[model samples]
Target: MAKIAFILLCHKDPDAIIKQAQSLTAVGDYMSIHFDARANPEHYQKIRDALKDNDHVTFAAKRIKCGWGEWSLVQATLNAVEAAVDAFPRATHFYMLSGDCMAIKSAEYAHELLDRRECDYIESFDYFDSDWIKTGWKEERLIYRHWFNERTQKRRFYWMFEAQKRLGITRDIPEDIEVMIGSQWWCLRRRTIEWILDFVKRRKDVMRFFRTTWIPDETFFQTIVRHLVPAHEIESRTLTFLMFSDYGMPVTFYNDHYDLLLSQDFLFARKISPDATELRRRLGVLYSSDGQRFQISNEGRSLYKFLTEKGRIGRRFASRFWEKESSLGRERELLIIVCKKWHVAKRLLERIRQMTNIPCIEYLFNEDSCPLPDLGGIQSTMGKRHRHRRALMRMLFDYYDTDRLIVCMDPANLDLLEDFGRDRSLTRILEIECHFSDEYLIGHAMRVGLAGDRTPPETIQRLLPTVRNDMTHESDRIRDANFENFLRVREVDPTDVSARAISEFLTVPQDKAHEILSHDHLYAD
Candidate 1:
């Protein structure tokens, strides 16, 4: 029987922490908890009172004021680990976790797995060899003393950094140590942790050197464990499932991620939202169940990857709207169709696809309409609706492998018009202004329901300014107009699929063509 000792660094949410402790210690496991000194005293008291009767649970005697990217976090963790060791002398392995971390597997499974493997589970990498640091100073983070906190004192931190650079001031890392960096979370064998703690006590020079380092918690244990443990005795990956965005922010898990969580074989997952009570309760049941070993599902992993990538692309695309160079996509020509009714736009989209064999998007921004699923279900970020729509448009333009794309967009979506209007080099707009027709009014009524009473005309009326000034309007008001000529005037290729589609579209009898194009039903491709 392996006795695992869990050390949790917690700040807020007493109830969630209480539930987590109860679940882990139910099967004779030992736990040590450290509450941030900066948090309210009531939180600590509440947790203590709730777990008062559990002999398996203990609280660290020393609470430290912790801040992001500060040495206090490492110090606090050390205090908790020391407390756990003294209290639970028989603990076979030590696992470091956070308040937001949840056990995704049974305790028995973890104990048995750790017992069989009998190796330190931590990620230790040579920082200089990897591109792990996304946007910040890399080697500077270690060589230069970070006197100011990076997050709270942004200006001062940068200023001091520059001043030190100009002055050529640098600090020497403690001798006989290779600087290593990785995730702050790790699970280590009892002897490995005991060795590390003993080393810290014996070598005050190494401790002093790291005290001034930036985000020492990420490097302290990782570097030390690598220095002492043999190569084969350590695993270069963590047992905890953690993910970060392209911008280096932690990806948080919510209640909706239960299926994704169950598909992985990780022992635990961190940064689970504190308000996710249902997720916590369900995971608690799974953790306590007498279930078989968890299996890794390739389909589930791929789905998770796709979702995360979709979100990343959406965010990346949305962030570029304010910049002068906003267009980011495959280097290809883009044709966008703007119409009041989605059904009409979708019809045009299908026709274009038929002529060109190019990828056509149907109602890219229509919440009710489906976009391409393989592109990983582009989720809209609320409140920034216009920005979200524009981001998706640009991301799709970037995502498609073909040299051209036909997208159906609503005319009321003026944000994209204004956006594409600024960049006409590779983008062409084939807008159909039919807001005044009876068919348009009927489609508007059906789409908007009661809200369509006054808003349809009002919406079109508001669009008049941008349409007249920013866009080329060719309406029924134009006499003897040619569809192919309209596209040619906008610099469409004479032999392009768009031109071919329009030329064929014009060959149909006028009334029959109007009836085919004016129908209110959406085109499903």
Candidate 2:
């Protein structure tokens, strides 16, 4: 029997936790709970009473008051893990669940899936682009600035700052290093959990940092795991929707419109509604969880049986002219040549055709015009009118099979490339030798190139000329200051010969380079 443990940190919602716990118990899995310190003793007792019949449940020794943006919740979770490990040493897996989390599938099926993958089921939690920080609607500026400054402070504040700075960050850190942002809720293998606990014990500085930061729970596990485990071992896809909000909008959980989450690929989902009557009715046909096996439920079984009985009728109805075989042949190395316009795509194709004879597939996003002229390939046009350029690019790459190699024409394409880089199977190879007339575009290109197979350090260095030149045109002084600060933080000397080479290569005049370089205002914080 596979042993799986569920760890939950609960605050006021004892009833919700109890229901989720009951569902787990019904599925025959062990569970551990940590009531927030703020929960009344009587309420805690009531919660314990609710789960008393389940011999597998255990309570934590430490309780914490959890608030949004505070690290107390994470503290409680860490404390719960120590407790769970002590109580259930034999368990093979530990899943960090929330009071609101619901099991869409059976525990046994989930176990079989994890056992097959041998994966540590956690999202790759790393820093996103610095752009996210500037664009982030969340009121995290004071917290982020304080955390960045806190790095030089006393050990406690330093760790707290590190935790805050790293959490939910997508980009704009040092380019060479890859950072991941993980969900607070995840399932980990026993060995992985043991490794995490041991690593944290040794890293006193990281622990001390956690002391001051709020919501260190999510950052702590993600950062520790990244340091210990290979990037390939971590799952970039999350099983839950913890990141998205639930505003009681008319969203469907199990319908055609809501297919993104319910699609067979995801392992877990977050914040499942307690009142999921509509979801229950709609999903009754697709999934059903027995105590052990999560198989097709009775409703789905009947539907499938009916369809099978209808055989030729169903086949005839399903047959369509547009439904060509979805198979892309034996998984060859696919190079996703991403292009915005037909002429640019043609140029990229010409380059690829000149260098290698391999079959190249092009993904273009122009709605009004079809760029390729009889290339004998599939073409898709995005319907939405607005600048869904980013979203369209994301969807195109998401559809890419991991067996293929992806190469984009532009570096700005790197924004989409990072998402694919997180996937272990996909290989991102960049044709760095090819240069565009617009060097400012190189930063975006380099980002795309980095997302693929590793490019030499010198290649990235060569591209810095384009990056610095583009930096000069920015009207925002604060953004320019931050960009310079990033350079200073990395300790790259502007006076270096290589820096001079980059300054000379820019389209801007030599005087402008000196002017921009000498401008004290650009370096001012």
Candidate No. with top TM-score: 1
Give per-residue CA lDDT, model 1, range 110-225, as digits (tens): 87888888689998988778765655568888888887765445457779989989999998887799988888889998899899899989999999888889989889999999
Expressed as tens digits, the lDDT of each residue in 389-496 for candidate 2 is 333322223232112223334333443343333322233332222223443244456554632337666776676666555433321232233321111111134434
Which residue runs of candidate 1 sit more than 4 Å off their true CA positions?
A: 298-301, 308-525
| lDDT of model number 1 | 0.68
The lDDT values for all models are: 0.68, 0.49
In model 2, the worst 10-residue window by lDDT is 482-491
